[model samples]
Target: MTATCTWRIWGLEASLTVTDPHRLGEARSIVDTIVADVDRACSRSRPDAELYGRSIRRGRPTRISPALCTLVDAALDAARASDGAVDPTVGRALVSLGRNRHLATESGRPEQAAHADGTLHVGPADHTVIRRHGDMLVVPEGITLDLDATAKAVAADLAADVIADEIGCGVMVDLGGDIAARGETPVGGWQVTIDDGPDEPRTQIALQGDCAVATSSTLHPRWRHRGRSMHHIIDPATGLPAEERWRTVTVVAGRCVDANTVSTACIVKGAAGADWVAATGLPARLVAADRSIIGCNGWPAPDRLAA
Candidate 1:
């Protein structure tokens, strides 16, 4: 039994598939519930969202919902593990880059601008703690934290897990291009197409049960600003758009959150990102700006064109 449904959520076209014939509606309902919950939990545009409320209060320890708390903990852990390369406190920088508004509906083109100096302290998970000091204002009043980098992947993983546990069937959650799957459906693994642009398409990826995949690229929806083309991925160290050494990087990991974390880190790491991905023993595909394709040792190349 095969059924598919698509809708807009988390700033992208989300699609779900369930192999159980009798549970099609159930699967779609579960996906809808999860997407709504994720929107409530992570949306920065909402005035009353926990993150937005916390951001407005400025430096005070605001209590967050359990789901958001979990995401924050995951993000902070990733930041520590990646040596601050995947910092979540770059919200201010993102806003200054004209991403302060929601991307899903905002039609204005990307614009770049210099940002004020400041630092934000996230938490010990128990309380918001100011771990360091910097010149920039800490937590600008009314600032919104965009979890575009990680939340959707987290939602996909969570939704897949919950659906499988409750319905006793396989589940696949695709939030934009980030995906998570549980149980089984496809014979070899879920076939995924990697798109770099119209002219260049690469091999399909086979993702198996209970795994997550995420891709980060400097080419998507990017625009020129101040004599330089800037993408959404920002380098925390420089407080600027990351240098585009690699056009795209994809990572497969044990969890969607980890995949999300590492994929974003790869963009900032540039050419060395491929070596770092290799050292982790995780499968990865890297497309350089020069159009060279590189994959981890075990990643299979597609027999036919991916497009």
Candidate 2:
């Protein structure tokens, strides 16, 4: 019997497929268990989630769940590699930009304001401190963290690994457009559609065997703040939206976490990001804001799809 199911988890619609003459029921059970576990581990809105606990607590390193720890550790390493181009402690900035709600929700709430006296640190892979003085939550001189950019990728990787191990079949996990796949599938590779904002042409990417793919673009929802349009991809150096250079960047790497992490960093890196991605030897496609496309290193032009 062949069965497929689609449900929302980790802020995106996750589709699971299973094919087996026997153990169809068992397959469904395993998929459901993975979805539930991923939701509990990565849902940012959940106040009790390990991520939230760490974020809410000012200077304390709360003991995180193993799954959450894995995600965080990956994010921290990415932050270091990018020289702080990607950060995991930008929850406060994301909140301030009115993106404080879960992706599945229809409405968003304004981020609570930090205490007036709060000071934040902004640098590459350094200890950050935040303190509260009376009504103000100070960032303790200079410390900034933004993990929203990389957390989704980490979660996708974790979900894919967990699903493949438990079900012993192919697993495709997508957090928004970022995806990771493992095991074997009926099709030669998974088919992925890339949304390049509005009124622009969409592209497709194929993943075979084991690979992680992540797409970062400025075309997502945004709002005007201080007379400038603000997007979700924050630059840790300036604590502001990244400058518009490429409209979108899609990267394929050995792991979903790396793909997702580098994609976000590439957005902030601008034209220089192309060189950076090429140097890493990962296959990547970049779409400029002008609609021109460029392929880097091992990545081929969109016309050439691997079969």
Candidate 3:
């Protein structure tokens, strides 16, 4: 029997499910710890949070927790994979766009964003001491890190794996719409509902064993600034919202972080987005600003009969 519960977390909703209903409590506890660790390490809004207003400014090495280092590493990997389409160095750009730590509508101090001259860098391989220090992160001066792009997905992936390992059962963790699964597959596998905001067509898909699904959309989490519409997905090149060639993009991958990375990058890739995702060969659904759906790389067609 699959048991699940929902609650608010990280300014979003989180759902946890365990194949063995009795393990729900244990699973939830594990997930709670994972999310707390992430928030404590990566929160940009909390004054006391490790990353709050923390900038290296001038290629200086800064000390951070191992957990945060791992998260930043993932973000950098995403940026590298997407060719800077999904950048972790856009924190200051976001601030310039009026997004504060709370993601509130109020404008923020522009000085808090990553500087125009980007010189961000990471430490050497795991356990290796680099030119400066051991396990020390060298964030360029004025480069503020914002791991928001992959934070929730990281939490989901981490929670699912930890819960399954600790409880010896199948588990699925969904942070907002970023979902991850591990261990045994339930009776019908993992049925995921893809909904990108209101009035948008929705669909369901199934997954088995370990897998992940995530969606990035421009329809929601938007606001008006300087009398112009804006969104959270910033194009590092322009230091502004992704030009909305595609309104939403969802991808399924072996991991939630990868899925989110590709999906978010798809939004920023603009006209070449579909082709870009198609090249990755991951099944994905792209919805244009006009709400027209385009399925690629084996994405299930809505008109096709379910077999």
lDDT to native, each model: 0.68, 0.64, 0.79
Candidate 3, 136-225: lDDT as tens digits: 777554455678899889989989888878899998899989999999999888888888756787888888779999999888788776
Best by lDDT: 3
- Worst 10-residue lDDT window for candidate 3 reads 122-131
| Winning model by TM-score | 3
- The candidate with the higher TM-score, 1 or 2, is 1
Candidate 1 local distance difference test against the native: 0.68
lDDT of candidate 1 over 69-104, digit per residue (tens) = 656666667777666767766665565555543422
lDDT of 3 at 109: 35
Error of 3 at 99 (Å): 0.6
Candidate 2 lDDT over residue span 225-287, tens digit each: 545577878776665578889888889887877887788889998878988888888888888
Q: Give me the overall lDDT of model 3.
A: 0.79
Residue 206 lDDT, candidate 1, scale 0-100: 69
- TM-scores, each model vs. reference: 0.82, 0.77, 0.87
After superposition, the stretches of candidate 3 with alpha carbons farther than 4 Å from their true spots are 53-59, 101-134, 303-307
